[model samples]
Target: MKKIYSLLLLVVSCASFGQTIYTENMGTPTGTTLIPAYSTGTAPATFQNSSPIAYSGTADVRITSVSSGYTAASGGGNVLINAIAEYFQIDGINTSAYTSSGLQLSFGINTPTAVTNLLTVEVSTNGTTWTPVTYTPTGIGWTLATISSGIPSSTTLSIRFTSTTASQFRLDDIKVFNFDPSCTLALGTPTAACDAITFGLDTYTVTIPYTGGTSGAYTFTPSSGTVGGDNPATVPVGNIVVSGVTEGTGFTLHITKGSCTYDANAVAAIDCKPANALPFEDKFPYTVGSALGANQTWANANTGDSILAIAGSLSYTGVTSTGNSVSFVGTGAECQTPFTATTSADSGLYARFLINVTDYGTIADASTTYFATLTDGNPSNHKGRLFIKKSGTQYQLGLDAASTTTNFASTLFNVGDVVCVVLGYDFAGNTLKAWFNPTLATLTDATTPDLTSTPTTAITTLGGFLLRQDSATLTPTITVDELKITTTIAGLLGVSQNSAIAGLKIYPNPVSGGTLFIETAANAEKTITVYDVLGKQVLNTTTADSAVNVSSLHTGVYIVNITEEGKTASRKLVIK
Candidate 1:
């Protein structure tokens, strides 16, 4: 009688924790593919297919199988790369009513004996930061795993489930609320946990839950590695960053705060592919007066009459340029270059090119005419698009994260001026970042991006980049050169691996005047050697001051090689 009474009291107390905030069955996958968005929800959310950055080549289609109820599954083949991950985001979920309240998340997962990779659950409030709270059910049959966490009292709360990896697993029925069965602490660990690589060492960051958290001092212990982070704990209930972890190692994390001990399995980093090959880079290396699209490695919709290869490629600050430029107009056809699919963990595809709008169509038109866009598997969906719409005297260079025809970022551009564009999509964040004529410091630092927008439509994967030739009444005549797309931003801009030799910049690339500056990260003395396209070394000088006298060089295309601290990088230099 005494035991039964105590059990009943505990159950009643846990049940009184809170009410259901939001719940979703996630619907059923229409055959093999999971639907991008549920059209019924009032709350905002985004779903995406993600592959680890370490993986090389095209992304696999987000596969699903149905035995009865629809569930999310994974494709199998490669032993190393394994199956890609799925990211489900619950955005702007209002939890203001549950101030200082604890929350619970429950999901149903069923895996087969063949499925090897484990399912990891990560929670977050803001989109950028994430905390791995618990591991989902690993049982062979349908097993429900309910994890609890202290959710912050904000109207813009977000919970993310990263169905990281699997081959024969089925994940279905996800729900989030204050409590369903009770307020029991099933998997209430830290609210936030993430790994950061600093100087080749991996650091683990854990944040204390806001509402029902430990008080005073806490303890952290690793299974195999040495534990060194702020010993003798400061405030015990705040954020803690555990350091001194070796890279590529998995371990169990144990945190003790008074009696409420929290323990979970963790990895310094997820196991991913080792080498990623360069996707595509074209300087328009075609014969002068030759056609562009079809036979020239660039794919176009028609006979490729809309584009013509012109002489001399445009130059940017830190990137290498070669071959010729392509002049294009709105002629009904579109030219596209498909690269290796980007499954970047964070920022998706990084695209950089030099563009000069020669004519801004009609001055009275304000309707958007898209020029460049990052396309997906679907031929109709141009995920992230760049447009030029006439606004008053000048034209506004606009960027959109989705294929939406209307809204875009506004930055003025002139007729004859050359503009270097750096655009990329963040698959994990579901946002796109764009920059106009950014400097070496600007690109490397990743601050002051001209525009950033969340995707208006649910785009699954980014596979190619296209230059659309819209109607002549909409788009302007433009010249494009030195186009490159890759997995990483550093790779896209050709940034050096060594930090000391990074941030290389050359201004006024078509150097017509007297002096041209070559800058490096350390600002040390560097050797400048100029070579003409004929492979003849014309000028060589060593200078500490980042300046080179280009007056001696002739008016033609030349290669300027700069060696800083024994590290060499060549940039295409044109002296007029």
Candidate 2:
């Protein structure tokens, strides 16, 4: 009875814990396959065919059979060709298999390639008269081909090719080939438990060439020697690898036949566990001035430095010196995994913040907190601006009106309603824009979006500042990385925040007097807390468990505070 009661109590506690921590912020893709590689006859057996030779000619593919008479039976036993679906460009495709062709020979198959190789095809207007569809150059590799001009306007098309002048003809390999895309393989973030894992895969789009009569069986399975993980499901022309892949530090997805295999940053390899659905980011509680331990900052904060921390916490004494910059410190950040911008658009530093948001304390006060501090009036009379601090529910960017200048304004962002937020001041246009996710904020000259909010000249000259999150109230749960601040919008688009898994999240935001669940990683030791609207701590607890509770709290708007080690995270919670 005692054991059973304890177990039931534990379950209840977990349910209650979940009620307090609502996972909202989602992690970005650690890595993606922009361009994958595909090849004919590669190791790990990516394709199959009866007698398809791995297309390997440097130029356009060509095949000549002497006594075949353009007959399928006479050719080298039905030519079966298979190529990795995603990667490769078709160079050139031309069929010349006939010796005074009797009837118009036409056929083709549309697989991952541009089109099948066959003739005797035609296009009909109303199922009556048929017109020959013009042959077009497959975009795979061929650069020059103006054959798509005479294409008929009918879905039903038949083609017929007769050897009028020449009695002999030959066919070559479809032209398609190109370099492979880049890839990275890693877990949410590299920590102790499961950080030393990796996975590699290929990706690309292969254009088919040919029309009709090209029939054969095709299949796409996981590459050979795949130590584990579900195999890729074969599609009409592509293959989708939808499985939780886990590999040790040295695992390799070896490829053959000139196929490009990218080490896509799947997750931190450590967190690559099979789940019912795609894994979401783990949510951490948030607080201020939380201790994130040592090694959060670089040995010597300077240019060309990097740092690595999921929920890192740090504090700056003052924004002093001319060439000062704080960043996530680590070698991987410096070498293997450089930071990229949040999206391909927008302006900011790579994954980390450049701390350019004006108005830290209401625009007039000249005090920098968190990673930067205020300084005396400068030649430009510019007060420094502190960057964003990721809370459990919102991202605080910009300064309070009184902190920097009387014109400073900050932007707060939440999940779903706002996935990404960029607080920027465009100097060229004298504009302050706060873009949320896909929602663009047109500069309307409002007080919040006023261009005079911050000393644009001072902020620009600072070349931006970098700060680590340090929560003072309870424990901060939010995690931020890939912080970048830039003047040019083009530079911001180049940042990739999806590198580190950043896999932290909570669920059921705005809890209504029920269970609050928090799901996070094994290596994370977090502290969870609850607060009222008055900024008073109501509940505080710390454990390695994945859930928390707030059922006892009053029914109203509250804040959940999470502190891991010293890094604090906070999110607003509602009790029903």
Candidate 3:
């Protein structure tokens, strides 16, 4: 009995000898979402909420390294990564009571086997100044490691982990404490999206799912929107909602349970832009070989095979070819064009674009490839996607509300054929409709659509358009140009009929100042009026010369409406 009591006393003495002041076992991480920091557990131990780790250096994530069943993970990283965990104060620690020689730090580590690869730990009171304390590992397996060499001379502590060599490390059970009398240490994401706008209040309600936290009825508060929902509960688990959300803004949610709180990963509210009023068109009017997306209307254009504005344009039956067009050779990065946003109440929205398939690329068996989609502000949420599959040497076009395997067209169209494709969405009906090369009389909402499809899941919002360049196997040299999007079919047909005499070309588009050249088939007398994206008139002038003095216009996207006699041609212009 005396021997057992002595062992227990020795263990207690060793733990308290280090004066375990702060310890983080690290909170249990769930799901595949990479954890940004240890924010799940209680305060002082777990750095969260008020204490956030600047996990910006590299891919610092909660990894599922093997644990003998204690908790699931440790902070993990790859080679040559530097990360900083911000400091916070514990309630009872007195900095004056401890000295640099008496302080100790301990943690569990599992590192890569490279002999030169090492995990260097640095301590900092303020984030700027740092002191290195080395904890070299002897093996690749999980090892409880401790070191007490160099310590920061501050009450609170922050840590920076760096590895200069190509190695990996798992950090867990971290402790920063002392040797005299004080006590010892211990330790511890949400994807938020729009739910719906409650009918009565007419405000957006958001739902966020979290991976780490004590499971209970928690009241969630948004950093921007208010908390409200129908079939209400004071605290909601699984389902929580927020109202009055603003679009095109940075958004974050705070979860509260009793006195404890957790902050979810930051996300933005999808821009629920108003439905387009004017006819929005992009003729790919930039200089040939000029890559899309920098100071241009397209977003993420430089990502894929470089969404470059290649020479030439797609000529449609009624739409005259003017500027250069964009093509998809295979798949690389997805690109977005912010044209207009459609609300849930909107029933009709239409888009028309010219497509010409030069040749088909490698496609998986029985699988179709999507080239275009109607997306929300967060371009990932595709509302209605346009798909195409190869049927022999020819290609078949398809449409879906949100499905990849949506049916393809029965009529096989040949490659090298410039075809006008019109895709539309009816939110109230939850239907995706399309028409191929329709004349003015045939292009009415009342007329039966050429292709019709219903979505498997209901779509609520539509804010922009996205071009798919995502798959390597789904390769096809598809050229697209003369794109136009609007909420009504009248908006699609509102442009004046294309006549040879009235057909005009604007170039070295992305007018580089000097003089903006507008070339016509006749070079006839014309009056030009330019309007910005918001339908605000920026430039208006009557010029008989094909070249108008557009040097006065600032750099932006503008719609140049050139009127020749009674006929008018509206084209998109990007002033560089």
CA lDDT of each prediction against the hidden true structure: 0.55, 0.28, 0.58
Model 2, TM vs. native: 0.21
Residue 297, candidate 3: C-alpha displacement in angstroms: 2.6
lDDT of 1 by residue, 330-428 (tens): 544576665545664435677888998787756355766778888863336688888777766567777786555455556677787789888887777
| lDDT per residue as tens, model 3, 125-206 | 7667777777766566566667866865465556666666545566666556665432211111222333331111122335
Instruction: Report RMSD (Å) for each prediction in the order shown.
Output: 21.2, 23.9, 16.7
What's model 3's overall lDDT? 0.58
Tens digit per residue, CA lDDT, model 2, 1-576: 000000000010101111111110011111211111213323211212112222221111112221122111111111122222211111112122211111121222222233332322233334346465445434332122212233332222222232222112222111111221221111111112222211112111111111111122212232222222222222222222222233222121321212222221212111211111111111212223222111111111211222323222222221111111222311112111111112223332211122222212222222223333221112112233333454444445454213333332354554223134344544444334543332222322232432134343333322212333322231122233323343343434432211122345767776764777765554366667675554345787666777677777878987675545333344567777
Name the regions of candidate 3 deviating beyond 4 angstroms: 1-277, 301-304, 362-367, 495-576
Which portions of model 1 miss their true places by more than 4 Å?
1-279, 344-347, 361-363, 377-379, 444-446, 495-576
Residue 466 error, candidate 2, Å? 11
Candidate with top lDDT is: 3
Superposed Cα deviation of residue 164, candidate 3 (Å): 22
lDDT of 2: 0.28
Clashing pairs in 1: 131-193, 348-425
